[model samples]
Target: MSKHKKAAPQQRQEMSGVERLGLRVSSMINHPIAQTQRWVVIHRLDTDGEAEWEEVIGLLAETPELDLTFNDDGAVTVRWERSALQERDDFIIDEDNEVETEVAAPF
Candidate 1:
């Protein structure tokens, strides 16, 4: 007789927007090694078509925990674990700050 095991139910944990984005950034930076100059862009559909590339770069620059490398071809790559986490947090924080500012501003 063949033995079979039942799969366990998946558990979903509640995470803040910052935490969610942090997870995403972590996953991206942890991707398998590839060519040094291939740039990976993360795009958001909201904010009137604004791209998050510069924000990512800035986060990398500001945080020391993240080891960000730029290739001669102008492609940026993140290769460290802690750095990835820091960058992710920075992105989320910056985004939240921007939203708060926009909400408080008089149009």
Candidate 2:
């Protein structure tokens, strides 16, 4: 008889503290509100997350999709721009079928 083993090593695996902090950082920077509260994000990173500062910097630098931008106001924000998310001139249903869109812009 064969020995029984765990079904999945990664199934429902708990994230490490670093992973959790990374998630929080991602959410804060990616949120629409972050654009207006850039300083708040920086302040939190400086004070609350000071210990993990190096890890945070590594995450931002190592991530090819994430970009660190320094604003004129002295606040920094991270942004990710997926190539697939770029604006298309018209609506697309499928590879062969595209529907022209009438933009609501008055200009």
Candidate 3:
């Protein structure tokens, strides 16, 4: 049998403006739903030299069932159904407080 080894982890690529923004927003909540409708927590760096958390809700193109609420304080909360099959598998999306702080901070 031929021997095979696992490949090393690749370095993260530099994010574009939109990606940066998305990444920032994704790191400030807990248990974000993935593309498969599974909940996952997103982690990222913050301005205060700390880690932050966030959540993301995956949405299907054919089925549209997501809503967003934005507060005056720059905070956002999103509510959406987890799966089309479930009667009530909704989730809330919150702002990545850490990322927001990071973006606002003077680099």
Candidate 4:
């Protein structure tokens, strides 16, 4: 009889503290309010000091999607071009579709 060997279960990689922070920052910046204003201010929280926040901002700024400005009051202002978001097809509104949906009023 041949001996059967069981395969070990694979473990999934988890987000690091810094990565988690980055995700939160990204989400806040991508929110409708923030995206509409084209800017968002991120203040340092009690859990993270200026240095720590700076590190997180640095990591999150690695992408070309955001523009970061470090403030003297330990805040970082992030901005992105509307065009950057508009490049995505979903962001584009189809005016033609809206016109088509407008039905003539009944007499």
Candidate 5:
């Protein structure tokens, strides 16, 4: 037998003024038409946002390959470099079961 009990569904709650304002203002930030698209994180509660933001900043700070900077206007910059998949050399297996890089023809 289980010790836990199934609770009844809670009643719906109305949105607070702060929540409504936050949602409205927060929505305007990423919606600016200057940039066609950008990544965004939406948190329903403001309480845990600080910790999450700090974690992201710490991750960016500790990673050597990642570029992390905070602008004076509260803008954050994060970018990284990666080799294109097409730039990688192809591989082939010989009848003798030896693996070798396939040579490319010169243009």
Candidate 6:
């Protein structure tokens, strides 16, 4: 047998902007400073563009885990609704998890 190790399968891919933002939000909530934080700040870079921001916010709004509010300075504040999140624990979408999509191959 050859002494070379086999290449690992390409299982991991780069995270999208929204996915990264989601992870950040999760981290903030779990952080110790979250105890007194009333608002979770999100800058433009978090979403890349206005359209991307809209899309990210739109997706989060659909879930009951968190609430998002826009600030005058163009930052987004995130509010976690623990009860709602607990209830949706069975299907919570977080940074570490990937949303599944099925695509049919074009013949």
What are the clashing pairs of model 5? none
Question: TM-score per candidate, in order?
Answer: 0.33, 0.39, 0.32, 0.56, 0.33, 0.53
The model with the greatest TM-score is 4
Model 1 agreement with the true structure over 23-80: per-residue lDDT tens digits: 5654554433211211233333243112354554666567765556676765555544
Q: TM-score of model 5 relative to the true fold?
A: 0.33
Q: Which one wins by lDDT: 2 or 6? A: 6
| Candidate 6 Cα misplacement greater than 4 A, ranges | 1-12, 35-39, 90-107
Model 4 agreement with the true structure over 1-104: per-residue lDDT tens digits: 76987789889998766666666676766555665566778866676655656678776587576688888996788887777766765343232332222332
| Higher-TM-score candidate of 2 and 3 | 2
Ranking by lDDT: 4, 6, 2, 1, 5, 3
Comparing candidate 1 with candidate 5, which one achieves the higher lDDT?
Answer: 1
The residue ranges of model 4 lying beyond 4 angstroms of the native Cα positions read 1-15, 49-52, 88-107
- With a 3 Å backbone cut-off (N, CA, C), the pairs that clash in candidate 1 are 65-83, 66-83
* Model 2 lDDT, residue 27, Cα: 57
lDDT of 5 by residue, 2-103 (tens): 999999999999975455644443343223220112222233245435555555456546756545557665445544333221132331112243234343
Q: Give the C-alpha lDDT of model 6.
A: 0.58
Candidate 3 minimal-lDDT segment of 10 residues: 98-107
Give all candidates' CA lDDT scores: 0.44, 0.47, 0.37, 0.64, 0.41, 0.58
Question: What is the C-alpha local distance difference test score of candidate 4?
Answer: 0.64
Q: For model 6, what is the error of residue 45's alpha carbon versus the real structure, in angstroms, after optimal superposition?
A: 2.0
Ten residues in sequence with the least summed lDDT for candidate 5: 32-41
Give lDDT tens digits, candidate 2, residues 18-56.
Answer: 676667665555444432322123323434355565576
- Name the regions of candidate 1 deviating beyond 4 angstroms: 1-24, 30-51, 81-107
lDDT per residue as tens, model 3, 14-57? 85544564555444323332323322223233431211222232
